[model samples]
Target: MNDECDFCRIVAGEKSAHVLYEDERTVAVLDQHPAVTGHSLVVPRSHEEEVLTIDEATTTAVFETLRCVADALETALDPDGFSVFHTSGPLVGTVEHAHVHLVPRFADDDVTLSLSRDRLDPDDAAELTARVRDAL
Candidate 1:
């Protein structure tokens, strides 16, 4: 583990974090500065500088853990929806380890989407979904 990384500190129990879930491969914890009430972070136990740097096994494990935590968050918080995102830039204020952000959204909350009043057509959405699935 990198001694300078915040995630490393948390994983080492050298820092305080509101942990949600943990396993051999990953850990989920509440975000200190939450975008929503139930905003949380999902990270791998191993320290990797970026998502692309993680091994295939670790990457798969991280995503699987994320899905489980997301389901639990939906059931527990009952948010209107949620978003999962990851940042990989070293200068973007992202920690030096790969992680996913799970931000719960409420209908009346401040979190807003970039999409305007014009909605995507169902066919377009279907095509996009197909492309994403193909990529995966």
Candidate 2:
């Protein structure tokens, strides 16, 4: 874990967080600045800057914890829906440590989390699919 990272500090118990769950591999905590009341973040104990660079075991642990936490949020909050997401890279997100956001959504909330609604042309879609499939 990087000493300079805030999440690393929280993981190390050098700093305090409203942690909801913890095991040998990962930790889940309430987001200090939540998008909704039950917003939480699941983070791996080992420092990983992004999901694409992490090992398979850590990735599994993180998402498994996310699922467990999501279930808990659902039972406790009984929201209309839920949103599980992550932000990677420096361009569009702030936190450097890899984490997943589990947001509980209510029916009447005036909030919308969406990406561009633009539809790609068929040829462009095919080209993108080919690039991704070939890379895999």
Candidate 3:
């Protein structure tokens, strides 16, 4: 466990969090500062600063836990929809440990999670897609 990481401390039981589920690979917990009423966080037990650095097995476990958490939130909160996302980098990560956020969304919640409407040139889009596919 990473002593300097808050999430690692939570996983190690050194800090307190409203943990919903915990297994060998991941832990699902309630977000202390929720975006909506049912916001929760799914964190991998092994410390990693970002998704790109986490191994594939742990990533899969985290996502599976995310699905379970989302389903539970839907049943409990009855939100119109929900958002599942992860933040990376120093500017947006807030916490250094990699974690997925499951935020319940209502129709009138006034929260916006839309992509920019700006259109990219077709060639640029195709090139970008090809680059991503090649990288994969």
Q: Provide TM-scores for the models.
A: 0.79, 0.94, 0.91
Name the top TM-score candidate: 2
State the TM-score for model 1. 0.79
- A best-first ranking of the candidates according to their TM-score comes to 2, 3, 1
lDDT of each: 0.87, 0.90, 0.89
Question: lDDT value for candidate 1?
Answer: 0.87
Local accuracy of candidate 3 as per-residue lDDT tens digits, 13-103: 9999999988999999999988778889999999888877799999999999998888888889899988888888977757888999888
> Cα lDDT for residue 54, model 3?
92
Which scores greater on lDDT, model 1 or model 2? 2
Name model 2 segments beyond 4 Å from true: none
Error of 3 at 123 (Å): 1.4
lDDT of 2: 0.90
Pairs of colliding residues, candidate 3 = none
- Which one wins on lDDT? 2
Model 2, 80-122: lDDT tens digits are: 9998888888886988898998889998876578787887799
Pitting candidate 1 against candidate 3, the one with the higher TM-score is 3
Residues 89-131, candidate 1: write the lDDT tens digits. Answer: 8656557788998999888888754545787899999999999
